[model samples]
Target: MNECTYKNYDELPLMLNVVQVAAVLGISRAGAYELVHSEDFPTLKIGSRIVVPKDKLREWIDANTAQK
Candidate 1:
Protein backbone atom coordinates (compact mmCIF):
# COMPACT_ATOMS: atom_id res chain seq x y z
CA MET A 1 0.00 0.00 0.00
CA ASN A 2 1.22 3.47 -0.79
CA GLU A 3 1.46 6.16 1.83
CA CYS A 4 -1.66 8.31 2.19
CA THR A 5 -1.25 11.89 1.09
CA TYR A 6 -4.17 12.93 3.24
CA LYS A 7 -2.97 15.27 5.95
CA ASN A 8 -6.38 15.70 7.52
CA TYR A 9 -9.87 14.31 7.64
CA ASP A 10 -11.08 16.79 5.04
CA GLU A 11 -8.79 15.13 2.51
CA LEU A 12 -10.34 11.70 2.96
CA PRO A 13 -13.00 10.31 0.71
CA LEU A 14 -16.54 9.69 1.97
CA MET A 15 -15.90 5.96 1.78
CA LEU A 16 -12.55 4.25 2.09
CA ASN A 17 -11.29 0.89 0.88
CA VAL A 18 -8.92 -1.50 2.69
CA VAL A 19 -5.82 0.11 1.20
CA GLN A 20 -6.97 3.58 2.21
CA VAL A 21 -7.72 2.35 5.67
CA ALA A 22 -4.22 0.91 5.95
CA ALA A 23 -2.70 4.20 4.88
CA VAL A 24 -4.85 6.21 7.27
CA LEU A 25 -3.90 4.00 10.15
CA GLY A 26 -0.27 3.66 9.16
CA ILE A 27 -0.60 -0.10 9.24
CA SER A 28 -0.07 -2.92 6.78
CA ARG A 29 -2.85 -4.08 4.44
CA ALA A 30 -3.07 -7.36 6.34
CA GLY A 31 -3.44 -5.48 9.60
CA ALA A 32 -6.17 -3.30 8.13
CA TYR A 33 -8.00 -6.45 7.00
CA GLU A 34 -7.78 -7.83 10.52
CA LEU A 35 -9.17 -4.61 11.95
CA VAL A 36 -11.99 -4.51 9.41
CA HIS A 37 -12.94 -8.02 10.47
CA SER A 38 -12.94 -7.13 14.13
CA GLU A 39 -16.38 -6.93 15.78
CA ASP A 40 -15.93 -3.34 16.89
CA PHE A 41 -14.58 -1.92 13.68
CA PRO A 42 -16.96 0.14 11.53
CA THR A 43 -17.58 -1.30 8.08
CA LEU A 44 -20.20 -1.66 5.42
CA LYS A 45 -20.57 -4.81 3.31
CA ILE A 46 -22.14 -4.49 -0.08
CA GLY A 47 -22.30 -7.68 -2.09
CA SER A 48 -18.80 -8.81 -1.10
CA ARG A 49 -17.27 -5.35 -0.99
CA ILE A 50 -16.22 -3.88 2.35
CA VAL A 51 -15.83 -0.18 2.97
CA VAL A 52 -15.49 2.21 5.86
CA PRO A 53 -17.22 5.55 6.14
CA LYS A 54 -14.84 8.42 6.74
CA ASP A 55 -17.11 10.01 9.34
CA LYS A 56 -17.46 6.76 11.24
CA LEU A 57 -13.76 6.14 11.03
CA ARG A 58 -13.12 9.56 12.56
CA GLU A 59 -15.61 8.85 15.30
CA TRP A 60 -13.97 5.52 16.00
CA ILE A 61 -10.59 7.17 16.26
CA ASP A 62 -11.94 9.80 18.63
CA ALA A 63 -13.60 7.19 20.77
CA ASN A 64 -10.49 5.03 20.94
CA THR A 65 -7.87 7.75 21.23
CA ALA A 66 -5.91 7.59 24.49
CA GLN A 67 -6.10 10.52 26.89
CA LYS A 68 -2.90 12.18 27.91
Candidate 2:
Protein backbone atom coordinates (compact mmCIF):
# COMPACT_ATOMS: atom_id res chain seq x y z
CA MET A 1 0.00 0.00 0.00
CA ASN A 2 1.22 3.50 -0.72
CA GLU A 3 1.87 5.57 2.38
CA CYS A 4 -0.78 8.12 3.25
CA THR A 5 -0.58 10.76 5.91
CA TYR A 6 -3.14 13.23 7.15
CA LYS A 7 -2.53 15.98 9.66
CA ASN A 8 -6.10 15.65 10.85
CA TYR A 9 -9.45 14.05 10.08
CA ASP A 10 -10.41 17.15 8.14
CA GLU A 11 -7.78 16.18 5.60
CA LEU A 12 -9.48 12.87 4.91
CA PRO A 13 -11.62 12.39 1.90
CA LEU A 14 -15.35 11.87 2.37
CA MET A 15 -14.86 8.18 1.73
CA LEU A 16 -11.80 6.01 2.24
CA ASN A 17 -10.56 3.05 0.23
CA VAL A 18 -8.92 0.00 1.83
CA VAL A 19 -5.42 1.36 1.36
CA GLN A 20 -6.39 4.72 2.80
CA VAL A 21 -8.02 3.06 5.71
CA ALA A 22 -4.92 1.02 6.38
CA ALA A 23 -2.79 4.14 6.28
CA VAL A 24 -5.08 6.17 8.50
CA LEU A 25 -5.26 3.45 11.08
CA GLY A 26 -1.57 2.56 10.82
CA ILE A 27 -2.44 -1.04 10.06
CA SER A 28 -1.33 -3.44 7.39
CA ARG A 29 -3.30 -3.80 4.16
CA ALA A 30 -4.41 -7.28 5.17
CA GLY A 31 -5.47 -5.95 8.56
CA ALA A 32 -7.50 -3.24 6.88
CA TYR A 33 -9.23 -5.81 4.68
CA GLU A 34 -10.08 -7.86 7.73
CA LEU A 35 -11.43 -4.77 9.47
CA VAL A 36 -13.62 -3.85 6.54
CA HIS A 37 -14.89 -7.41 6.39
CA SER A 38 -15.83 -7.44 10.07
CA GLU A 39 -19.58 -7.50 10.74
CA ASP A 40 -19.78 -4.30 12.82
CA PHE A 41 -17.48 -2.10 10.76
CA PRO A 42 -19.16 0.75 8.93
CA THR A 43 -18.59 -0.11 5.29
CA LEU A 44 -20.49 0.54 2.11
CA LYS A 45 -20.51 -1.55 -1.05
CA ILE A 46 -20.54 0.69 -4.07
CA GLY A 47 -20.95 -1.70 -6.96
CA SER A 48 -17.89 -3.95 -6.62
CA ARG A 49 -15.85 -1.57 -4.46
CA ILE A 50 -15.92 -1.32 -0.70
CA VAL A 51 -15.52 1.99 1.08
CA VAL A 52 -15.88 3.52 4.51
CA PRO A 53 -17.35 6.94 5.00
CA LYS A 54 -14.99 9.34 6.77
CA ASP A 55 -17.62 10.54 9.20
CA LYS A 56 -18.74 7.04 10.03
CA LEU A 57 -15.13 6.01 10.53
CA ARG A 58 -14.70 8.82 13.05
CA GLU A 59 -17.84 7.77 14.85
CA TRP A 60 -16.77 4.14 14.81
CA ILE A 61 -13.42 5.00 16.31
CA ASP A 62 -15.09 7.08 18.97
CA ALA A 63 -17.59 4.35 19.77
CA ASN A 64 -15.07 1.56 19.86
CA THR A 65 -12.34 3.48 21.62
CA ALA A 66 -14.68 4.17 24.50
CA GLN A 67 -15.24 0.44 24.89
CA LYS A 68 -11.60 -0.43 25.25
Candidate 3:
Protein backbone atom coordinates (compact mmCIF):
# COMPACT_ATOMS: atom_id res chain seq x y z
CA MET A 1 0.00 0.00 0.00
CA ASN A 2 1.11 3.55 -0.66
CA GLU A 3 1.89 5.65 2.40
CA CYS A 4 -0.26 8.63 3.39
CA THR A 5 1.62 11.68 4.66
CA TYR A 6 -1.23 13.52 6.37
CA LYS A 7 -1.12 13.53 10.17
CA ASN A 8 -4.88 13.58 10.55
CA TYR A 9 -8.03 14.18 8.53
CA ASP A 10 -9.02 16.98 10.89
CA GLU A 11 -5.98 18.92 9.75
CA LEU A 12 -6.97 18.69 6.11
CA PRO A 13 -8.65 21.51 4.26
CA LEU A 14 -12.47 21.55 3.94
CA MET A 15 -12.20 20.44 0.34
CA LEU A 16 -9.49 18.52 -1.51
CA ASN A 17 -8.60 18.55 -5.16
CA VAL A 18 -8.02 15.29 -7.00
CA VAL A 19 -4.26 15.33 -6.41
CA GLN A 20 -4.67 15.99 -2.70
CA VAL A 21 -7.31 13.31 -2.43
CA ALA A 22 -4.97 10.88 -4.18
CA ALA A 23 -2.22 11.56 -1.68
CA VAL A 24 -4.57 11.23 1.28
CA LEU A 25 -6.05 7.99 0.02
CA GLY A 26 -2.67 6.53 -0.94
CA ILE A 27 -3.87 5.95 -4.47
CA SER A 28 -2.32 6.77 -7.80
CA ARG A 29 -3.12 10.15 -9.34
CA ALA A 30 -4.88 8.48 -12.25
CA GLY A 31 -6.85 6.32 -9.85
CA ALA A 32 -8.04 9.42 -8.04
CA TYR A 33 -9.33 10.90 -11.26
CA GLU A 34 -11.09 7.64 -12.04
CA LEU A 35 -12.72 7.63 -8.63
CA VAL A 36 -13.96 11.16 -9.08
CA HIS A 37 -15.74 10.08 -12.25
CA SER A 38 -17.31 7.00 -10.69
CA GLU A 39 -21.05 6.96 -10.08
CA ASP A 40 -20.89 6.78 -6.28
CA PHE A 41 -17.83 8.87 -5.57
CA PRO A 42 -18.58 12.37 -4.34
CA THR A 43 -17.04 15.19 -6.31
CA LEU A 44 -17.49 18.79 -7.34
CA LYS A 45 -16.45 19.81 -10.81
CA ILE A 46 -15.07 23.27 -11.19
CA GLY A 47 -14.73 23.73 -14.91
CA SER A 48 -12.00 21.20 -15.71
CA ARG A 49 -11.04 20.38 -12.12
CA ILE A 50 -12.59 17.85 -9.76
CA VAL A 51 -12.69 18.09 -5.98
CA VAL A 52 -14.05 16.20 -3.03
CA PRO A 53 -15.41 17.54 0.25
CA LYS A 54 -13.67 16.16 3.33
CA ASP A 55 -16.87 15.35 5.19
CA LYS A 56 -18.48 13.59 2.25
CA LEU A 57 -15.37 11.49 1.78
CA ARG A 58 -15.55 10.38 5.41
CA GLU A 59 -19.23 9.56 5.09
CA TRP A 60 -18.67 7.60 1.90
CA ILE A 61 -15.97 5.54 3.56
CA ASP A 62 -18.18 4.80 6.54
CA ALA A 63 -21.07 3.87 4.29
CA ASN A 64 -18.97 1.49 2.21
CA THR A 65 -16.97 -0.23 4.93
CA ALA A 66 -18.31 -3.41 6.43
CA GLN A 67 -19.04 -3.20 10.14
CA LYS A 68 -16.91 -5.36 12.33
All models: lDDT? 0.94, 0.94, 0.87
TM-score of each: 0.92, 0.90, 0.86
Show the lowest summed lDDT stretch of 10 residues, model 1.
1-10
State which candidate has the highest TM-score: 1
| Clashing residue pairs for model 2 | none
Clashes of each: 0, 0, 0
> Which clashing pairs does model 1 show?
none
lDDT of 1: 0.94
lDDT order of candidates, top first: 1, 2, 3
Give the Cα error of residue 42 in candidate 3, in Å: 0.5
Compose the digit string of candidate 1's lDDT tens values, residues 1-68.
66888999899999999999999999999999999999999999988989999999999999999999
Score residue 18 of candidate 2 by CA lDDT: 92
* Candidate 3: residue pairs that collide: none
Candidate 1: lDDT of 61?
A: 94
lDDT of 3 at 52: 94
lDDT of 2 at 50: 97
